[model samples]
Target: MSEVNEQMMPPKVVLPKLEKNLYEARAIKSFLLTAMVWGLVILASIPLFSVIYMLIVEGGARLDWEAITALPPAGFETGGGFGNAIVGTLVMVGIASAISIPVGVLAAVYLSILEPQSKLATTSRFLAKVLTGFPSILAGVFVYAILVITTKTYSAWAGGVALAVLMLPTVTLAAEEAMRQVPQRMRDAAFGMGCTRTQVIFKVILPTGMPGILTGVILAVAGAAGESAPLLFTALFSNYYMAELAEPTASLSILIYNFSGMPFENQIELAWAASLALVVMVLFFNILARIVGRSKF
Candidate 1:
């Protein structure tokens, strides 16, 4: 009777043993940890959003079409555009780039292509490093000596010259790095093709390094745009017509400074608007740099 009962019951099912996947478990755990870290970082952007919100709230009311299109403030007017400051900033920075870019590129080329054991290059490189660390206020003082006190006037030329000094190290370093990135084989090939050292550098190396050079210029321009100390001493302040190059020339940054310190709420609002505009201008250049760097020569 017992045998018949066992035979009637279903046979016990057998299942395959599960493999222990320690590696996959560990991988999943690591992925979770990384995702958590990034998630926390994303949340930390809340303050940045808040600041943007405050800026928009305070500045938006003052950013009407007329505020954007009107000329510089006239004798304590509540609302005025920064037209002259904008133009002056552009002209001064343009001149600064004109002076600095060529000299910087030349210096970079010399460092990359000239004597392998040059004491001059070493000295110049050390000086550039020192200059990079120099405080902006010190640069302003230097310009003050050269362009303001000695010249006895605050010319736009003086401001441009000050900006040139401020920009030189950045351009030189960027250009040198770009030059270093040029493949040695290309240089060798150029030499093999009966090209002179100058020809190879100017034609092949420079073009390839154009990306870095342009990046340097953009950074320099951005830096010059935000500077206040150098401009303060060299350019001083002006609320009226755009002064001569040898006289005080107000800038957007200078205006922001002057306006923000006022007791008027409207002036403070203008400061915020101006600050936003400056940030946008810098961002514009950064975008331009990316576009230029990616373009085919």
Candidate 2:
């Protein structure tokens, strides 16, 4: 009976191959990963596509060569453009870029390369971050107090200064980050080659980091171009073309602000057209930045 019971007992089971199940699990994981990636892509695309669609629908019909060349008309009368505003925007943004790029890049070089561990560098870096987050309106107010008040008049020069203040930290931090991204090994190799510090930096490091630094400058300029609050306080608005840097200037943003609220359909249309042009300007700068970032040399 005992022998019969032992014979009826279950035999030791043989192990099945785990490799097949493992491969199946891996396939499932890969599929899930692909699905997640596509899901995120679709999620991100919704808002971007929506903005582009809105811009086209609302502004496409209003865009014309006149919009780019003629002075805006007065009152409710139709048949005008934002030529002065476009030109003023360019002039002010150019001034801001000229001011910020050199000072910002020099500060970045000092902080990132010269004396990174010094107290002054730390303070400068901290101040830059603070300024970067400072309110745009406050920048306007600051410039208004300093320049406009001193000069007793709002001018394109004041507007340019305001934009320069806004752009300084952005350019400095971006440039420093770009410089930091240069491989330490490359720096060491330059040193091993008996290159002087200045030689290595100017020849090797700056070249390697130019793409990112230029990208930052381009983006900063785009942001400066779109700003209305600072220009409102500093540049004011002019019905005519800018005659001098110290005179009030027209900009696309201020035009949009001035026109969008007017109880006139003509002005409203001009606003939309100006808005479209501003959007195109910013988009072009972004594209240019991307191209620069991807460029080699």
Score candidate 1 by lDDT. Answer: 0.81
lDDT of 2 at 278: 97
Q: Report the poorest 10 consecutive residues by lDDT, candidate 1.
A: 67-76
Model 1 agreement with the true structure over 80-197: per-residue lDDT tens digits = 7766677778877887899999999999988877853599998888898888877888888898897688889887888888888899998888888889889999999999999998
Candidate 2 local lDDT, 194-288, one digit each (tens): 99999988998889999999999999998999999888899999989999999999999999999999999888888888998999999999899
Residue 189 in model 1: shift from native, Å? 1.0
Worst 10 residues of 2 by lDDT: 16-25
What lDDT would each prediction earn against the true structure? 0.81, 0.93
Clashes in each model (backbone N, CA, C under 3 Å)? 3, 0
TM-score each candidate. Answer: 0.85, 0.86
